[model samples]
Target: MAVWDFAMPSPLHLCRAFHNSWASWTASEARLRIATSASDTTPLPAEAIHAPPLPPPVDTVYCSTDAGFSGPDRSPTFGFYVRSMDGAFVAAASGPLACPYDPLLAEAMAIHEALSWLQEHNYHNVQILSDCAVLVASFRDAGSYRSYLGIVLDSCLRLINSFPACSVKFVRRGSNLVAHALAKHVSAVEARTVWRDSLPPFISPAMI
Candidate 1:
């Protein structure tokens, strides 16, 4: 038998060790690579992302994100809302994530997806808000993160830096109710939504 096989740890033992080692830090983000990805960073389009030579002023728009899970084993869903500088709703979306991720990593994925949505629409000056304080703080030290979550966060940072005026800020739960509602509804329906110009009535109460 191989030497490693003789000393392999049990699943329970490994889980316990991992939990203990990372107990102090929450797991809000995790690395992900698509089947066709050329590299880890490429999974997030980092290579092709380019910032405008002269970007708009900060807070040209505002975006908020939240994650909701229908069950412990199911992938989490995420929702995001974009608003004009004066707080008029511009767009909103909610959808299930591509892969099953822990709650924290799911929240990170929510941030990533929301960023992707904004960038795709050329919103370079939009500011992102997340209720998860830990994930928001991860942006500051992403360079030093080497774990799976680090990979996800580093990609997020790269995307954020690609925009000359974009930033991610921590938002309180009360302010993120719309995003939370969007995500929660998607999780319940196990589907996705995209709202632009007109929104569903169910969303109005949450907006208030």
Candidate 2:
């Protein structure tokens, strides 16, 4: 039998106490491995757990329709701008016409043209930002448009659905300056223009 002194125990005494308790519980190899791992910043080779991949980031295209209204006798002109995902200049289109159409209808038609171009040019997986909440909501609802709006709405819906997938959102009018400026230009004149590859000098800086 070993006689142990408790009141005057030294450092060796405490070490022996810990060893007696843990020596039988853990294998000597495990203890050595734990010590080696604790001193190293790199973990053990087999300890790493694999993680699943994440989804790709979303892309957005901001578009706005501006219906330029003149006096009672004139037909309102329509213009639109499509900005790239990072707000860079993409393209713009505008036209002047005399039709007994409401602003909502004109907005819908402008969106229709933009989407048509997108489909024709093979742009897929996009979110559309607009300033016409009602027009967007109408597209989402799909079945509640008024009877007189049937032709244009149907054409627009078909064009929209033909995409890989597109989302419609409304933004502030102030944020839609490029399209509004184009609409103002079309309203004051009697011409139509479709811009691609580059934008006119005046509207280029703001778009970028």
Give per-residue lDDT, candidate 2, residue 140: 62
For candidate 2, list the clashing residue pairs, or say none: none
Please provide, for model 2 over 81-161, each residue's C-alpha lDDT reduced to its tens digit, 9 standing for 90 to 100.
Answer: 776667676787777745565787777766766777677778775556567778777876656666656667788777767
Among these predictions, the greatest lDDT belongs to 1
* Candidate 2 Cα outliers beyond 4 Å, as residue runs: 1-60, 187-189, 202-208
TM-score for each prediction?
A: 0.67, 0.62
- What TM-score number comes out for model 1? 0.67
Top-TM-score structure, candidate number: 1
